[model samples]
Target: MFIESFLILLALNFLSAGGVNRPEERIVGGGPIEIEQAPWQVSFQIRGHHICGGSIYNADTIITAAHCFFLSGAWQDPRHYEIRAGSKSIKSNGILVKVAAVKVHEYYVHKENQFFVLQNDIAVVRLSERLQFTNKVQPIPLAESNPEPGTMSFATGWGNMYGADAGDANKIPIHLQGVKLRIQSPNFCVRFHGQSKICAGDSKHTICTHDSGGPLVINRQLVGVTSGRGPNCDRPATFSSVPYHREWILNAVKSFPQHV
Candidate 1:
């Protein structure tokens, strides 16, 4: 009986932490959105499974959180990843393209103790082939300036619909989802995530686990990349500020010019 109980507990832990159907890929308090509405969104998958969210930077490039490529304290190979674009569903629909290269920010860091810590959590992904642009497959422009606190922003992803404490953390949605979040002041964001992150969200709406590497847009401009969140889904979420790293992003894209 004791052994059986122990086995059950172990299985539950694994399901909660690593199960693909688990709540890790959620946009809490969000609703289904059409692919044409957020055409720049993409799914950063590993071995055909949606692991993180990203945004289409151009026909052959994607921008996502660097931590998406980090697993078990190590960086995964770029070859193991692919980008699914022009779709609203993770299970079906979209153009799957091979990943040619992944470039993480030079200052990015990943540390683990009781909890994981990520810094400078941004990355750029080069695609193996150029994407054919359509109304449902377009690029979003990077924000030239950060939005002031109280500005409204939008976040999209295919993560969990409920918080971890809600006893339904495994409720993974089938279609893409989005929510409106209010940008918090730099002082408020820095207090929790430091200066390198942009803070946004509220008690009613926020990003969740699989939402990492997703885009946070204001006025249709990419202002942030989803990075982290508080203990609950209702709390504010943090992102890598696009404006703060705009130069690096531009240079990175330039260094990897598209082939004719």
Candidate 2:
């Protein structure tokens, strides 16, 4: 009885220490992701502080979770965000691009439930200038079709391994991280929001704080965008389904101004 009580207390402490469904979460049981392993991975920041991970979809366009811009309040100004590409380390060298515009999904909504529920949690960021692709930088193609449930996928981010506190310096990792996770059934995550979200991984291969806005790729194609995740990072990580909103993304990218 005493041991069970201690365990319950420990769980409660963890929840209190790391808030649930943080804005930007990371891989909990993943290893270091090398600089060139995922060239399309980009660090989304505000004033040089890494807040979330994003993907380079084209020479001038990025895709991330809408919650990154819409959570806590209404959408924020694009000028307040910066995109850093070609860097494995958030603090290392990379091409910093000023945001030209922000395009969030029209139906996105945040709910204040026991779960940090997000619906249609997807967005795009247009760069002020075209990024020069190098050995360390490139664009990833979006999945034309959704990966079937149970398919294995890969996710990358710069979030913490220990928990969600950016102030906890010791838990923060400098190098980017990646984890292999299996895609869970849309029905499995339906309770959180609906079929628009994909739940992947479990408690071990979970997304923790600072990894939000990252991409879930299968066979080099982005199939999902990291959105809300559980307090423990181990709860099946929820992501915005990319395939479901592919049309919107393409239209948004096409409508945005392109720099020559």
The CA lDDT of each predicted structure is: 0.77, 0.78
Q: Model 2: residues >4 Å from true position, as ranges?
A: 1-24, 190-194
Candidate 2 residue pairs in clash (backbone atoms < 3 Å): 24-209, 24-210, 25-208, 25-209, 25-210, 25-211, 25-212, 26-208, 202-234, 203-234
Would you list the clashing residue pairs of candidate 1?
24-210, 25-159, 25-160, 26-159, 26-160
lDDT tens string, model 2, 128-204? Answer: 88999998898999887777878999999987798766556566678899999898876664355455777888778
User: Per-residue lDDT for 129-247 in model 1, tens only?
Assistant: 99999999999999988888899999999776776432253566768999998889865642455456788877678887678789999999999998776555556777888988899
Q: Candidate 2 clash total?
A: 10
Best of the candidates, TM-score: 2
TM-score of 1: 0.86
Worst 10 residues of 2 by lDDT: 7-16
